[model samples]
Target: MAKVTLTNMCMIYDKENNKVLVQDRIKSWKGISFPGGHVEDGESLIDSTIREVKEETGLTVSNLESCGVIYWFNNETGEKYFVFQYRTEEFSGELLHKTDEGSNFWVDLEELSNLHFAEGMDERLSMFLEKEYSEGFGSWNQHQPGKLQFQ
Candidate 1:
């Protein structure tokens, strides 16, 4: 049997302002990325995403649109990691300036390319920004980095 880990990430879009909320991470996987974290046992994927957003950004989000999923298979350990991706425009509550994870702020979607992104985030961003792709899959070993393909 393979070991599997489940996680989630959400894009909080302020459509009227043409900006998306991003976190400048201070922990592992540092750099700019959306708010997210590991799923708790017995928690639904959507719930986990919502909870993570609230914890990391201090905002409650709803009407989440399922953007897609990204997963990778580890050749050496036979471990698989999955990240559920979501985008939502409906949210409430005051945004937090910073958390133990990082600082939260809005950035123009067009400016994403100019900002430094967390590992593989640029590829992951495609799942949220482009409607054409729904899934991203990749394979890697302990010694090599994985390459993802969107589908």
Candidate 2:
């Protein structure tokens, strides 16, 4: 049987300045991306998103909007990865300088391309930012960047 995994990303957007909260993950995962984590057993996707944002960035977010989803599969290993995308400009908290997951900071949305990110992450972020609704189906390969069909 194939394994299925669920993850989420919560982007805190500042519409006024076109800036967003991003993190540089220096722990188990290494990259500059939004705060998020895997959905726990029996947890709803939305709850997971909120929990992850709080846990990773110390922010309590509300009024979250679902931006999209990503479906990645590795046929050879029969593993599937689903990443739920979310964004919210409504949140309240004193931003923490660092968390176990990484350092959180604000970056201009326009400058995201100039920052380093995990494989395929920049494209994923751009997809969320540019499109109102989007989805992706892809092959997930460990040794290489997988091919994704976007819509």
Candidate 3:
């Protein structure tokens, strides 16, 4: 039998400054990435995204726009992981500088590429920034990295 895990991530855009809020993770999947986490049982995807953002970033996000989904399948473990993506410009509350996850800060869009990003995260940005792609998928075994492609 195969197992499937669901997660959600949000790109909180500051349209006025051309910046996006990011987290420098110190735990699993360490590196600069968006604020997000696993979806709880019985929680809707949108709600999970909203909850995770607040938990991780100290912000209440609204007016969310569904970006798309990114998923990966591990051939060796027979597990599939899905990340439901979202973006929003509307948010409230004081942003936290750090959390149990990592440090949170806003980075200019142009400077994002220069920062150290979590594995596959650099490629994942297309789902939020590009209007054409709706999905990203990858398949791999335990010993190797998966090749991700957007569609």
- Flag the better candidate by TM-score, 2 or 3: 3
- Segments of candidate 2 deviating more than 4 angstroms: 142-144
Q: Which residue runs does candidate 3 get wrong by more than 4 Å?
A: none
Specify the poorest-scoring 10-residue window by lDDT in model 1.
123-132
lDDT value for model 2: 0.86
TM for candidate 3 is 0.95
lDDT of 1: 0.93
Return the TM-score for each candidate structure: 0.96, 0.91, 0.95
Model 3 lDDT, residue 41, Cα: 95
The candidate scoring highest on lDDT is 1
Clashes of each: 0, 0, 0
Whichever of 2 and 3 has more lDDT, that candidate is: 3
| Candidate numbers sorted by lDDT from highest down | 1, 3, 2
Tens-place lDDT per residue, model 1, 71-145, is: 999989999999999999999999999999999999998997788999899877777988679999999996899
